[model samples]
Target: MRLYWKVVLINGAVLAVATLLLVLGPFSVSRHPVVSEAVVLGVGLLVMLVTNSLLLRSSFKPIEKVVAEYDAMFERLEDERAASSARALAAQEAERHRIARELHDDVGQQLTVVLLGLKQLEQRVPPELADELAALRESTRDGLDDVRRVVRRLRPGVLEDLGLPNALASLANDFAEHSSASVRRVVTPGLPPLSPEAELVVYRVAQEALTNAARHAHADGVELSLTRVGDRVALVVADDGRGFDTRTDGDGLRGMRERARLAHGELAVTSSPAGTTVRLEVPSS
Candidate 1:
């Protein structure tokens, strides 16, 4: 039965017992002619009072325990989520470092050399073709902007300077601006800050989850949760979309789990006929 009903039933039983004692007091007292009726009635009432109090206390005790269990579960889930998210952030940061290294050694250097060659050609080109040359230069400038955008995504400037919260917020905002989907971002405050590695993991995990939801799941809604406990954190992303089969493994799921392992955490993917939930947990400082 429901908790409230059970409590009410317990209270009803207590009242019934008390009422029965009051109703039977006259007959029991009548049998005792030597004793005063008032004495018998007083003793019966005292017994009823004690019985009611004891039963009511017992009922409330179980309810208290139930509530405590719920609170404990919430805390554990939060811890796991935070740890998972931290892992994502760290992975993303590593990816950024790799991208930066490549860009600096390859693309950036090549682009610089190309720009120098264009400068030299500008001086030697025929006067009649100046218009076409200028257009070419403009095209090169546009390409440069595109490359810069890539670098920014690979190594989010905000990440190193502004920290995780701002970096996450910026990511959501930029993604929303660039994509057509309406993102529902839920970030709770007062969570203990994660380590740089932890932050990167969290971000990457979220990034993948959102991407899956948008690209594969065709989900209309996504939820991101970040919660903190004394020594752990949790990150959870749930989507209301076409769910996947748990029996089959995919790159997205494997990558997410790998990132979690990198952060000393774990990843769980729960999918049903109705929807899907990706949960991650990691430790916090």
Candidate 2:
């Protein structure tokens, strides 16, 4: 039966029992009652109160059970979703690694060969054409450099070759070199170990936060820190610049959040005119 109908029926039954007692039972209230009549009335009222409490409890039991079942169902669905996201992120990182390898081994080598050929050709060319050939050589060198940069971004060999600490240190140095901002990095000593996936997530989030600070925030100073918090490791990137609206989720912020979710971590972003901070916390192994 519908809950509303069950409630109505229960209330109706209670009212009927009360009416029956008033009409057919021995209890009665006079304009001025003696102690014995008052006692009898009090007893009847107590009986009615107990009966109503019992009925309400019985009627609501099923509802409470249903609510508990729904809560469990939702929890299971959330776990499944998180697992799926983690799998997808793993696949994405694998694909990126493959592409970076191909570019570095194939395209990068081909560009190097072309650059060498240009260098040889420049020596053989006439004096009139030397300037143009030199320009072409320079252009090829630039292209090769660009390719290497892309490969680095796609694979982050530093992260694999070194640990998370060195990877973050390299990132901070890169940011400082490319932007006007000064960066300070602090990694707590003897930190708890983190899983590979968690490390990558933290690295990516810090990278994105620093990129945003350099490109968009126009910050002059930034701080990147990794510390152990309880059983979890926390990565924080804070910049002293014009902050953005936290209500808006840009692509960078969304990507960070997705990465954090896959790692079973929590991400928080706070922004104001004074500065912006992106914080990510993940469990340690």
What is each predicted model's overall lDDT from 0 to 1? 0.75, 0.91
Q: In candidate 1, where is summed lDDT lowest over 10 consecutive residues?
A: 25-34
Using TM-score as the measure, which candidate wins?
2
Q: What tens digits encode model 2's per-residue C-alpha lDDT throughout 128-242?
A: 9999989988999999999999999898888888999999999999998999999999999888999988888999999999999999999999999999999999999999999
Question: How large an RMSD does model 2 have?
Answer: 3.3
The true-versus-predicted C-alpha distance at residue 28 of model 1, in Å, is 70
TM-score of each: 0.56, 0.81
Model 2 ranges off by over 4 Å: 31-49, 126-129, 178-180, 215-220, 229-232, 240-254, 266-275
Which residue pairs collide, candidate 2? none
Model 1 stretches with alpha carbons more than 4 Å out:
1-130, 178-180
lDDT for each residue of candidate 1 in 63-161, tens digit (9 for 90 to 100): 789889999999999778766765665556677789876875688777777766776788898988877777777777777777777887677667778
RMSD of each: 13.7, 3.3
